[model samples]
Target: MKIFLATGNKNKIEEIKKIFSMENTEILSIKDGIDIPEVVEDGNTFEENSKKKALEIAKFTNMITIADDSGICVEALNGAPGVYSARYAGEHATDEENNKKLIANLQGIENRKAKFVCVITLAKPTGETYSFTGEVHGEIIDEPRGEYGFGYDPYFYIEEYGQTTAEMKDLKNQISHRARALAELKKNIDEILK
Candidate 1:
């Protein structure tokens, strides 16, 4: 089973591959001659964005496509940076910029609770689509640490692990938000593949 994934994020591609490698499903990126369209994620919800991207790509390639839209939502900030996590600081800001802004926004604030959220959409060429969501509850730290992971991982601390996502590089496969989402995806794929 070779499914087309509508994304250019190498990190996401790698993560998905690692989880689904045993499923015997070849997850091919849109860059692999699929010519998938760049769908604008103007939706207010993660599910909307995910399904939009998946359906957009499926329309072009006429193949099964998977798309994900994820972000970090801060509880103290009223679930802020939720759908706009990618462009939180600015539309053109870098990951470092976004992280810095997030930290600064919480300066002097006691409650630093937050969570990482992911929504994945799977679409068939015939227009059928399904969605799944994953979330990892945690808090935001004042300082960054570790060299692994990207985005706000350095400051997103997991209560169960007692370490930031970046700091828990060795254990990311079992605790990260993406990992949780992938776990769900793998379960569904297993039933389908079998």
Candidate 2:
């Protein structure tokens, strides 16, 4: 079946495709001649935002749509950028801008504890939907470390691998928040395809 991935980010699309590559599914990006309406992500939680995006796009495309709303929650920041991760620096913040802002806000903070949380929502045209969540706990470093991966990957330190999320592309598909979420989604792919 053709699964429409509701996202404007190429990196997200690429990562998601890699995650589901083994499945017999066609993963299409929203950019593939699908001009879906942009949903206002004013929800207070990741699941809410994910559902909004998926349902809206599914309704428009008449196809099963998947959406993910994810962010890094810093313990010291009181999750200041929880739901506002994509636009943390501003409405149209770039990855670099958001990372810089995060680093600036975290300066001199003793606690560097943080975690990445991801919520995935799968929606059919009939309004049927399913939700799943995945999280990866780690700490944030004061400076960037890797060149790959987007958003806060550069500073997201994973103790197990002794590398940032960006530095472990090969391993990320097995342990990152997005990867875990997609893995859970894969477990229920039969229901979604139905």
Candidate 3:
């Protein structure tokens, strides 16, 4: 089965591919001759945005398309930067810049509550769509840790692992938000593709 993921981030694509592990599934991007129109993610929720992207891409490709919208929600901040995770700092902000701003915001605060959330949507050419969500609870650290992973991984402290997501890069295939979402997704792919 050829699955075209609606995303421009190579890191995200690679992570999803690793998590899925489907031999017949081929992940491709919009730049890979898919020519899917850019879907506007104006939704206030991750699931909404994921659906919009998946549906839009599926319409264009006339094939099965999977889209994901994810972000970090800080408990102290009342789940801020949730759906706005990618553009948390501002529109078109780099991962490093966003991570820096996040750490600055938590300066001198004790409650570093945060969690990563990912919502994945699968849309078929026939207009049928299904969604799945996954999350990993953790706290934000004052300083960034490790050099692996991407986005806010360096500052996200996983209580279960006692290390930041970046620090667990080698094991990210088993822990990150995207990985978690894919784990759930894998169970449904067989039915969706059929």
Q: What is the TM-score of each candidate against the true structure?
A: 0.92, 0.96, 0.94
**Total clashes, candidate 1?**
0
RMSD values, in order shown: 1.7, 1.1, 1.3
What does candidate 2 score in Cα RMSD to the true structure?
Answer: 1.1
- Model 2, span 75-191: residue lDDT tens: 999987899999999999999999999999998998999999999999999998899999999999987887777899999998988999989868888898998998898898787
Give the per-residue lDDT digits (tens) of candidate 3, residues 1-194.
67888898888878887787688667777657656666789999999999999998888888888899999999888898888888888999999888888888777878988989999999998899999988999999878888878999989998889899999866877887778888788888888777
Error of 1 at 7 (Å): 1.1
- lDDT: worst 10-residue window of model 2: 22-31
Which has the better lDDT: candidate 1, or candidate 3?
3
**Predictions ranked by lDDT, top down?**
2, 3, 1
TM-score, prediction 3: 0.94
Highest lDDT among the candidates is held by which one? 2
Top-TM-score candidate index: 2
- Score candidate 2 by TM-score against the native: 0.96
Better of 2 and 3 by TM-score: 2
